[model samples]
Target chain A: MSSSLTVERHPETRPPEQRTHRQVSTLPLVAPSVIALLLWMIVPLVMTIWFSFQRYNLLNPEAREFIGFGNFTFILSDPGFWISIGITILLVVSVLVITIGLGTLLAILFDQEFPGQGIARVLAISPFFVMPTVSALIWKNMLMHPVNGLFAQITRGLGLGAIDWFANFPLLAIIIIVSWEWLPFALLILLTAIQSLDHEQLEAAHMDGAKPLALFRFVMLPHLSRAIAVVAMIETIFFLTIFAEIFVTTGGGPGLATTNLAYYIFLKALLEFDVGGASAGGLIAVILANIVAIFLMRSVARNLDT
Target chain B: MGTLEMTRKNSRKWLWAVLGWLVACLLFFPIFWMFLTSFKTEVAAVATPPQLFFQPTLENYVEIQARADYLNYAFNSVAISVGSTILALLLAVPAAYAMSFFPTKRTKGTLMWMLSTKMLPSVGVLVPVYILCRETGLLDSRIGLIIIYTLINLPIVVWMIYSFFKEVPKEILEADRMDGASTQQELRHVLLPLALPGIASTALLSIILSWNEAFWSLNLTTADAAPLTAFIASFSSPQGLFWAKLSAASTLAIAPILIFGWFSQRQLVRGLTFGAVK
Candidate 1:
């Protein structure tokens, strides 16, 4: 096949005209997507930055004034802003730890030979597919309701008082719900990485009298580092912007208890009509996410070569 | 002694199997419970001890259908997801084709830049985009959502299709070119047919992501263009004792995407991780 293609291409190479034509056409072929993405990325970003520096509110559209750094100062000094930043960090870190740790364990479990393996795998991954609104509602009403929830029923059956999940442990509730949605993502990726591991290396380690812990630590851990990094970075990006689950479940509170930076910005923009403050908050979010995106982009760029 | 060892091994296998099954069931229980509750009456849905065995009824489904425009929302979801996916494909195929076959100094940077846009948190520009939508009367419109979805999924689509096109042997295209086939013919006859499966799975994954996109759908659409995500979110407020109806609504919202998701599990890992895992 290679020889025939090379022989056929020998005639086509005789013409410099067609080669230049193909090269010229490359720009037009790629121009549309590149231009569109460039506009999409730049326009809103510029507008957000501009708005962040002005004292603008949607309700009072006529009262636009350039109040440089005023919105930033106000947003920075707000108690809710500090609380939201804390919640955002806590939420992202907690969910990351839970998903990665649990995901690794589940991936290893599913790697073993078992009956109904395919069916179990399918079931395990279903939650990741469920829309965020539906998952939030299911957890909020069906599984976590103070009176009618399954946990309540179980507690009642076992002679203990039912815990009102959202009321008492709002952040933990959101964490559990978000973790449920993402744990499968981590599992699927890690499982793919594990399955790609060399079996001979493991056998050799076993032959060398390495116990299960040592083998996992030396061989499996090293192999899974790339996947683990990918999972951590990707999950951080998504977790930073987790809005719908909180929107549907707690509306960001029993009292701003579950409000992350994303929801806080949403509230400032839509509910309070504070565009300037929200834009400041929005810029802050962009900066926070960029910190993580830089790492993710570097890793993905490294993969581009192979 | 041999029999004892064999029994021990068999028991251990059973133990692992049981453990696996337990975890799977625990992970899947919320969905299963929702499915079960959707078929129950309002009274039965909220019954204490969680009625596991009740006479199943489609009353909630019927009520939701009668009261709300469930089909409208479903239609919007179908139209927006399908429309945006096709649009993304039209733009992505050419760009990915060029990037894969044609070597250039800037291609890698351009690809990385596209992905970096994806990492930009939607909230960062939510205020501006919302203002733009409101100004242009794109708010609560299908076209608005289609445009957004297309832009959002374009990077991933390009990446997926580029990877697929990379797998195609350059020899085939060169051979076709030598036969005096025009560029259109080469693409029409050689590329699309060869890349059909890749394109199809990419479309599938695109549909799933667009369908479950809750943030924009919720914030942008109020009633007219609300997709199933917004529809399910409408049940957030405790209006009546509508547990069964809410369950039914949630079930309807997720059913199609859930089925599509199961089929595209492998492509999902590939797409989400940008082929890093696969």
Candidate 2:
């Protein structure tokens, strides 16, 4: 996926006059996308920032006033805000650890010369295609339900009582559901990376009598390091903003157990109609996302250079 | 080299295959379970010690269409996803073409900046976007969803298409140019055909992502413009368990994209990773 820039300077490429003419034509062609994205990024962001400082509510539009950090102060002092931050970190970290760890193992395993490998891999990654709403409901009702769920049936068969996953462990439930959806993504990326590994390099390592674990640590793990990093960073960006799973499964409750920043803001903006408060929360989420985005952008920019 | 060693190797191969299949089935169980339940009657769906064998019925699927007007939501999903995909392509093809063929010092920065916009948490702008939509009376409209979907996905579409366009050799275009071909002629005759497969895959990815998108579809629309995402979410209410109906709806909702996803699995890595992995 290296840029085509390297190829253009080949001696037979276009003449300087034609190149300049094409460059001149490029602007009009690219302007629409640039302008559209600029508006899309700036307008809502500016509105959110402006609303964060003002006392605005959808229910009482005429009562708007400049509150000047009041919304932030309230959000900071609120216990739910702190709890949601903790839950957000927990969800993102746990999902990353599970997906990346399990993904690497699955990638290596499936990379082996096993019969039906292609079909197995296809089935394994199908969950990535399931929409968030459906995945959550499938886990909540079919697999995790206390009474009639598959897990309940298994537990009861073992003479144990059925456990209500949402009621008992809301955050864990969200983590499992989210992990199921994302593990496939990590696996897909890491597998592609691993397959690109030089077979001669692996054979040379094996010839040196490196044990299975040692070979994995020295050869495969190092080869996978960049892919794992990419997967982790990309997953972090998405996981921080996970909403529909909590919305469908727990509704951010069992007393604020599963409400990440996204759902928290959604509750404020829509349910409470507290536009100022939600906007303040919204800015906080954006700031958090930007912190992660900086690292991701830097790494992806490095790829562009290659 | 002995017979015993050959037997041991074959046994180990079988073991690995079995283990692989087991893991795959475990991961695929929930989706397969939903598929199975969709064919069962509602009562049998929730039956204790869930039924593995039963007289399969299409009642649940029938009920979904008759009671919920399933086709309306399906049509919305198709229109929003396909409409947004086409709009995104229209904007992206030109931009990607320019960026790929013409090198500028800022081109990389421009591409990176566009992707960074995608990382802007949707919730961060939810409050304002919702308000803006309401103010313009675009709320709960297909056009509204299409516009928002296109914007949200524009960066990815541009990035993917850009990478694809970068794969086309510059000599082809230059040769056409030397033949006195106009810019439009060069594009039509030289570029589009070379890049059509990439563009098609990009559009497939865009449509898949748009179809499965829950946030905007859930928030921005209700009955009038609700896509399948919102339709499935409606089942999350604490009403009596319609497990069979929910499964049927879910199966219907995901079937097309699931098949699309399977066919495009290889491209998924390239498209989703912004061409970094590939």
Candidate 3:
């Protein structure tokens, strides 16, 4: 492990006078990374703005022209845009509700000193480690498939015909897939937050004859507010751009029922090859997602201070 | 009365434990079923009345191997995941180290900016990035996949590593410098060793993210550079659906990462909750 650098035995702190220059040298260290992100991120973001103003299609290269917000207008007017927005909202909200609900419950369960806690914790968090595409495929195929899926098997076991879940409940199916991938993350964070809770407060609540729900509401909820908010913000930020899940499972199928914002932009570009319209759509989605993210990030940022 | 109350609480505890396992089973059964069905024949797989306890066979896996040599893609997955993580760490460690130990007004802003890059829809730049990759001859290559994944995982890596680095005091590095250790030497001897837990955790977390990454891997790599995710995707095509085979592919894809996650559940949980709770 100690290959190159020999450890000098004497470790001594530098004087305050000499430390300022040493600290200032950090400027050079971060510049390359910062500049790379700016060009790679913000520049393309600005180009998206530019493309939104033009009429460009990869299919018809000659049709490309400066449309002066025409692309944005068309993009906004597209019927799929609003539908996708609604579906995106539905996707985000449902995932949050399910994942956070399961997360907190599992966190509380794992928090208790119990036998097999280690294995339960492991099994509980295993879903989060799955690649999104693979998870979607698994859920779509062997789990939710009307014929061969376990969902179908279980249904038939109950003396019912198999349920075509994606065909019938595309949005719900997508919600479950994303939740399976993210629930472990929420659980991990929530459980950590729970562990940080003061035992004294819970003991006091117990002494005061507080019911379990009352103790959870009064004693635990406030303590968890920041962690919960962080969890919500983190999940929301990632959930907004979930593409592989939608792409893999339903492919926005069952008549656009599960066309989330990310998949919509993907379809516009990849399937339709409408570069300008898709770019505009991408910008629109960025704006819409940013509106949600900026608020969440702001709250998390404000909380990060304390 | 108190003894009765204690008994009530004990029974409730048992109830909660039972409830927890039940929930865990429901959540995990899909995976369990996929593994189970992988051992079943395609006929038994799609029988009208599904059977859970059929004689198992390796037919699906054998057929899967005939369809595609999975080991190659699995190897690519291993290479791409480890490669991206190492590359991301090479870049992010120094950056995180400098920012965490050396405070400035813009440090927080820089961190936020890095993380905010993730908010941008990846598909927004898909064509451009795809074009760049094509022109640069990086598309459908392990190097290319590694670069894309490194960028995707970089922000979180820096944030996690920075937070981990923050837990190590600046005074230690300062001490190293005072002992005539060069800036590079100080980082190597003091910062690196002291931050090994954070580094080890950062490596593990990045590996997990890269291993589980799907969007870029699917869109970017097709055959030559395809990873396990794409291996799973090959089961899907315009030809028609192959549910049993698809399940076999996906089960194979996730099994490695799931096993790793199960083994390191504690560390993974700790890393994911880096600054979240504290």
Candidate 4:
């Protein structure tokens, strides 16, 4: 937190009038963002909690009443709720593993001196920029469309029989799509982290007869632990609520196969119009995300102090 | 040394280069394929074995324009993303300015708390936001989306701008104050000019995030305010192989942001991780 420049003077050395004026000026400057965020956080949250306890359904407005923990109990007992939670964890963990695993290798690969490396890096990272809906549609139709998809063509050519990706492997299909979108993000971050690795250290390791695997194991991986942690934590928070890909691709179907927590809440709220049920589901998601957020905050907070 | 050793090293370099390009192409293939399909006839787009070389046509792009007002969706996307970015900057820049320049004991905690709010899942409040938007007559309105997008991105905007401002030397601000300049004058004339590049990159990052925001845009908007994200979602249903038009639309929807993303790739790491890595 300490800077080379000492901007803050001792209180007695500075004019009292100027100090108070500066302090007062900050309140107005900072108040708007704070107040807006406070309301944004509080209003919807309070309503979600309130509605979670009530017997509110958009279909039966007259049936609205104090339901106490009925909504929570209902959601907790539902098999679909547990299934969605499992899928959510699976999706998050799977994508995290694939992206970080491939990302580390790609980062090391792309980090080396190569012709057209700039263009290659740009192309490699391009998927990260794509809108989720667009990426999902591209995968769902063009690449995974069973008979006419590119994958089918490739498979048929190889005489291995075409695989109907979404139909046969709904969750796996989604995992692939989500990983494609995020792998570039992992690459971008890890590459930046890898670039910061000391070249002389690598040279020294090479001089000591370290093999490539040994260099990666001893030198590179340790340097990347913090960055990897950042990628995992940030990706987890986003992946837990991956709605658009599911919304556009499977519609949470093959009967809740792709219904992660976000899609589950959407189904309850919009599809079924179960206000209380969706609100209860929403709270569950919030709790799950907060667990990951705690670790992310700690890692990020460390950066702040430095 | 020896010519044999020199050739081996050169070959190894080429090997890495080729491997690097192969991986890059594999990753970029889907987008490239989408781009290629955009120009093909609908039949050719889904042809068995997939037509790599085909007579390209603008028919899909033209058909898409006629079928859906593609420009309307594009305009909505631009306006909403740009609107939200500007609004977030308006709110965040001043806040970040105050926090960075006039550091207090509570500033770090306040910043951290702001970021924690961002970690709250959007679905958690979907019901309430949906009902609230419906009740306030704001659902399907660009203003509603603009507001939501602004709030969603405000934390990162504030954080990015704060880090940027922190990098500015304090001596310049102190020098400005010695000349009897007011705080506003100090910010506008002195701090603003110094922090302009960082601010510009911050704006670019904000614009990119806002432009590609899917969750709120998908849930809240149906038609009138639907951005490209929602607009593209309309292609989800199987309507007897309209892959060509879908490709055209998808390509257009993602083109602008992808270009922006390429330009901001370096800033992305810094902005996304809230300057933690950099």
| Candidate 4 backbone collisions, by pair | none
lDDT of each: 0.90, 0.91, 0.77, 0.92
- B164-208, model 3: which lDDT tens digit per residue? 776676557666766899877887888788899778777888888
Chain B, candidate 4: TM? 0.95
The 10 consecutive residues of candidate 3 chain A with the worst lDDT sum are A1-10
TM-score ranking from best candidate downward: 2, 4, 1, 3
User: Quick one: ranking by DockQ, best first?
Assistant: 2, 4, 1, 3
Highest TM-score scorer: 2
lDDT of 2 by residue, A196-269 (tens): 88888898888889898999998899888888888988899999999999989999998898989899999999
* Candidates 2 and 3, the one with greater lDDT: 2
TM-score of candidate 3 relative to the true fold: 0.91
lDDT at A4 for candidate 4?
29
| Two-way DockQ contest, 3 vs 4, winner | 4
What is the per-residue lDDT of model 1 for residues A1-306, given as tens digits with 9 covering 90 to 100?
A: 121232222324436776666777899989999998998999999999999999999899899999999999999999999999999999999999999999998998888778898899989989999999999989989889989888998998899989999989999999999999999999999998888887888989999999999988999999899999999999999999999999998988988899999999999999999999999999999999999999999888888852
Report the interface RMSD that candidate 2 achieves against the true structure, in angstroms: 1.3
For residue B233, what is the lDDT in candidate 3? 67
lDDT of 1 at B119: 90
Which stretches of candidate 1 lie above 4 Å from their native place? A1-19, B1-12
| Candidate 2: Cα lDDT at A42 | 98
Model 2, residue A70: displacement in angstroms?
A: 0.7
